[model samples]
Target: MLFVSRAIDKLNDTIATAVSWALLLAVLICAGNALIRYSLNMSSNAWLEIQWYLFAAVFMLASPHTLRRDEHVRIDVVTGRFSRRTQVWLDLLGFVFFLMPVCLVILYYGIPFGLESLRSGEMSSNSGGLIVWPAKLLVAVGFALMILQGVSEMIKRVAYLQGRLDASAFTKHAVTPEEEIAAIKNANHLT
Candidate 1:
């Protein structure tokens, strides 16, 4: 269980790092587009569409990372006061009943949706816009990653509850999303 959890975490870390690039790229493009539009009075649908695509890419890819860090908003007031075990159980139940099902349903529908878009070579309604299938693909990718993280979390919680895992190994002492982002910025010399 520990190995499984660690592996999932490593995968999400790698994916999140890659996904972070989309944000940087999106910002640079947006700034450039704004500058070009204001200065030269020139703009293209492709550029605007690309920005939207990048935004969606970042959002979709970042979800697993958020879940891995347990950074998603929850009713902390209710759950925070519970005992640790109870909290874990509640999280597991929520995922099982709500998050996992929702992700699976979206993933199931998303694949065919993207595939049909690809098959038909779908494009945006705006002239000179980018192809639509790639953006459509993000839906399945996002939910799949979310489901993967959900399973990883459930495994860890179950192991802990069964006395096979250590409490410290979970969110007790973990590097947060903010810390990770700061580290990435520092590594890139952005600070």
Candidate 2:
């Protein structure tokens, strides 16, 4: 189970890294398109649509990585007061009940939506705009990845509760302010 969890984590990590670059590409495209439209009086619908596609890709694809790193938003004002074990249990419950069901629903609808678009070779209504199916397909892919990451998180939580994994290895979201600062410094190789 742990091995499977690690593999899922690795896959998400790789995808997240690519999505990060995609975000940068999106920004550059947006800026360049605006500059050309205003200065050169030249722009294409495809250029604008590409930016939209990259934005969608970044938001959709990076979600699983966010969940895997425990960086997803939480109503921590109450949960933060709970014991670590209680928190783990709560997280497990959230993954099993809330996260899994929501992802499954999205995937259930999203996959067929994408498939139909692809079957029809759906093009954007805007003149010179990009095809629509890729973005639609990305929605399904993102939710699918989220489901995998959720399973990995649940497995790690169960392992922690069973004392099969160290608390440090299983938990990730409890960094103190000082630890966060130190981490930033270390990441930059600063003294």
Candidate 3:
């Protein structure tokens, strides 16, 4: 179980790194597009479409890594009061009932959606815009990766409950503002 979890984590980590680069590329493209549009009064739909594609990829592909790192947003005001074990159990339930099912449904629908787009060789309406299939396909790929990460999380949560793994390591930890400030100070050598 641990092995599987680690493998999934590693895969998502790789995807997340690539997606991060995509984000940087998107930023660069945006800046370049703006400069060209204003200075040269020229722009290409291809470049604009590529930026949108990168943004979509960054959002979809990086989500699994966020889940793996236990960094997904939550309302901690209530969950904070629960015991750690209870929190783990709740998270396990959420993965089983919510995250997994949601991802699976998206994957179920997304595959055929992408396939149809590919079969039709769909193109963006804008002249010079990119083909639509790859962006359409990202939805399925993202959810497939998300499902794998959800399974990995569930495995770790169960392992923690069974006392086979440390709960603290697998669970989310909320950082306080003071801790955030201290980290910033340390990074700047202000402490």
lDDT, candidate 3, equals 0.92
User: Which segments of candidate 3 are over 4 A away from where they belong?
Assistant: 184-191
Cα error, candidate 1, residue 15 (Å): 0.5
Task: Give residue 12's error in model 2 in angstroms.
Answer: 0.2
Q: Each model's TM-score?
A: 0.88, 0.90, 0.94
lDDT of 3 at 136: 98
| Candidate 2 structure quality by residue, lDDT tens digits, 1-191 | 99999999999999999889998998998999999999999989999899999999999999999988887999889998999899999999998899999999999999999999999999999999999999999999999999999999999999999989876765565778999999998989964
| Tens digit per residue, CA lDDT, model 3, 43-118 | 9999999999999999999999999988898767888899989999889999999998889999999999999999
Task: Tell me how far the alpha carbon of residue 43 in candidate 3 is from the true structure, in angstroms, after superposition.
Answer: 0.8
**Model 1 agreement with the true structure over 30-146: per-residue lDDT tens digits:** 999999999999999999999999999989988888888878888878887999999999988998999999999999999999999999999899999889999999998888888
Instruction: Indicate the TM-score of model 3.
Output: 0.94
Residue pairs with backbone atoms closer than 3 Å in model 3 (clashes): none
Cα displacement (angstroms), candidate 3, residue 3, comes to 0.7
Go through the candidates in order and give each one's C-alpha lDDT: 0.89, 0.92, 0.92
Question: Which residue pairs in candidate 1 collide?
Answer: none
Instruction: Report the Cα lDDT for residue 152, model 3.
Output: 92
Judged by lDDT relative to the true structure, which candidate is superior, 1 or 3? 3
RMSD from true fold, candidate 3: 1.7
